[model samples]
Target: MPISQDRPFEIIVLGPPVSGKGTQAKLLAKTFDIPHVSTGQILHSIKDDIANPLAQKVAEFINAGSLVPDELVNQLVADRIKKDDCVNGFILDGYPRTLSQAQAIDTAVKLDYVFLVNVSDETIIERISGRRVCKNGHVWHIKYSPPKTETVCDDCGEPLFLRDDDKSAVVKNRLEIFHQNMAPIIEFYERAGILIRIDGEKHIEEVFQQFVRHMIYDLRNKVNRSSGGSPSGTATI
Candidate 1:
């Protein structure tokens, strides 16, 4: 576990809705020059490939508004990480929701860090509720991210509408389901001693910097311990 350059920085960033999991994951993936792999987006891309039968199957479940089965998801995930880009490591978002997938992922690769971004349920509700979007793809928030004009897209003059998923009842239900399903996955990583909890309620910049600092400190400590206090603590690009 000295994390030689031969191995990539495999990371998993997870959290409840509005916890900024994807946002932070993307930034870190860029910083590390690795792919930001999102299973949800992967499923979407697969759904668009009509000629591929397995991809079509993934599409069928999604088109029916049903949850994709874990077996298929696991297969897709396993296949995804084997691609060349992932050889340099990848930041994962929205995968391994269940213990089975978590175990499957472990068998496939050694994850460097499993970061869980935590935010209060109340803050999640507020963050989701304030989000608004227009048909033109412009998004805004009511409080901290308001548009230049009230309730209207500054570019298109289109009225912004709240997403159904952002409704209080919907968000609450989603959070409940997420935590219930993610409990075992979280426990799995914790038992492995690679899980790191992060505060997701902080400003985006603050959260990103805090995670980077913690990552560097812990990684350096691991390297030094494994190298018997040598210069392995200093990582090179």
Candidate 2:
């Protein structure tokens, strides 16, 4: 099916830490010729912008090592989606961490799809535990993308060390917290029938191919039917 120029595609990617949601979202945005709007990236960029009042408000909380309030996050997202770049469509990542945040966005826009990149807890642990970082902030995975020299960064030639957060215990703890926080939000989307689950344990390219196939299938079905149902299924591609 062809992408309609009449309506915008609003997509949201949700996943646990290290589940590759950000990468997948980026791919979707690029393929569809839309912007990848990542809240984490937005927050990081806003910290340095002293001119915008909202940026100043966001910076204060970030500098104080405090979580940005749901209201503020919703406002930021609402404002972001209103930008001219988002007129065609946008892929959203790293926002709506809570039920309130999700509901707030619900009022602002109707989403076409909400994809959850599902990976097993064991897979997440292995993926994160294998990560190593250099002092210069270069990242490498021991199993997937190993450095040219063991424990040495390819770019900086510095010794790579395991980040404290990458330890097995910490990864497990983060997974637990992620599930606890995301449960309600997931349920909300599931009820709305717009939630599609993708198996994230596959290789990166294969995972992206799954996304492409699913999008084509869903859009084609919607074009065929008078009232297309929610595309809810695990990606098999």
CA deviation > 4 Å runs, candidate 2: 1-6, 136-138, 147-159, 226-237
Q: TM per model?
A: 0.85, 0.87
Candidate 1: residue 218 Cα off by (Å):
2.6
How accurate locally, in lDDT, is each candidate? 0.84, 0.86
Backbone clashes per model, in order? 0, 0
Candidate 2 collision pairs: none
Residue 236 of model 1 has an lDDT of 26
Q: What would the per-residue lDDT of candidate 1 be over residues 154-224, giving only the tens digit for each residue?
A: 77899989999889899899989998999999999999998888888898998898679877887777778
Query: lDDT tens digits, residues 1-237, model 2?
Result: 222334458889999988899999988888898999999988999888878689889988999999999999888888787787887778889978999999988877888889899999999998999998999999999888999877899999999999998899998898889999999999999999988889898889998987788788777666556466554554455
Candidate 1 has a TM-score of: 0.85
